[model samples]
Target: MRIESPPPSGIPGIGLRPIERSDRQAWFDYLRLPEVHEHTSWNVHQPEDLDPLFEIHESVSPTSPRRLAIVDLESGRLAGTIGFHTVSDLNRAAEIAYDLAPPYWGRRLATQLCRRVTDWSFETYGFVRVQATVLVGNERSARVLQNSGFAHEGLLRAFRMVRGRPGDFNVYSRLATDPAL
Candidate 1:
């Protein structure tokens, strides 16, 4: 099923959309930037590496992994991507992941996108909990999650492998019962 755009981000001219094949080139351009990849655990190295991620699917399954492109609605530029890395119906939970192009950094765009997506996830999926993880030293990303109302939980030792070696992560969560942002 096609998930409608969550809601207005209130960030004039910036919005979310389902990733399309046409976005592959722009997505590749941003994803390949060294600075963009340094903090996140994106494994993409070449354009072809992202083909699988952009493959068209007829409808979204409840547990299917999803990634939505963040676009500049007015300019039609692919600014970033964000969505759930994992979703679980039985657990009533999901994990959110997102990244922004360097040009868009320091603009509060990530925080706004994160807040809107988290609200949509809870409303659409009836999830009790939404969580995010950031590499230990990624202060910017951690701040994004916190500004989006996610409370820092704790650090997970070697929770994820970035590039190659195991990297420690800080986990954060926002629950349905939490005060609305």
Candidate 2:
């Protein structure tokens, strides 16, 4: 499938670009952060564990989850990543996930990134709904979704396994008809 590059989001001082091969080390380093895995399902026990993900990132398709590297425009630093996954053309829906380095946390960057990607997905994919699942204790991410106009759907019991333990997650969603934040 031919995947068209999304136009640069007009947000100032931040940009989203494709994750490149050269980013493998940086991406690995970010994922290695203990805080990054605290609320996420990612289980990166070792460096080699990320090989499969890197492979997937290398050959992304429209039907597959589109991963975009979030960069600091002025410094050109890899600040984080955001992506839409579980896309269903028939259902016109998808799920979103994101992570930022600890240095970028508490800055409302996640909210801006979520808003940009949500708009892009709805506009480019004609998705009627975009969903995001946040670990139950992750108030920050939940707030980011809500701030981005996503409504709380419900709790998903044992939704994911984080660090080998079953975890509950809160499901939030935004519809194309929802007012933009």
- Each candidate: RMSD to true structure? 1.7, 1.9
lDDT of 2 by residue, 17-43 (tens): 886656666677888887787778888
TM-score of each: 0.93, 0.90
Which regions of candidate 2 are displaced past 4 Å?
1-3, 58-61
The best candidate by TM-score is 1
Question: Which one wins on lDDT?
Answer: 1
Clashing residue pairs in candidate 2 are none
Candidate 2 lands at a TM-score of: 0.90
Scored by CA lDDT, what does every candidate get? 0.84, 0.82
lDDT per residue (tens digit) for residues 30-122 in model 1: 877888778878788778888776553224777766678788888889998888857787898989988888889999999999999889888
How far does residue 78 in candidate 2 sit from its true spot (Å)? 0.9
Candidate 2: count the clashes: 0
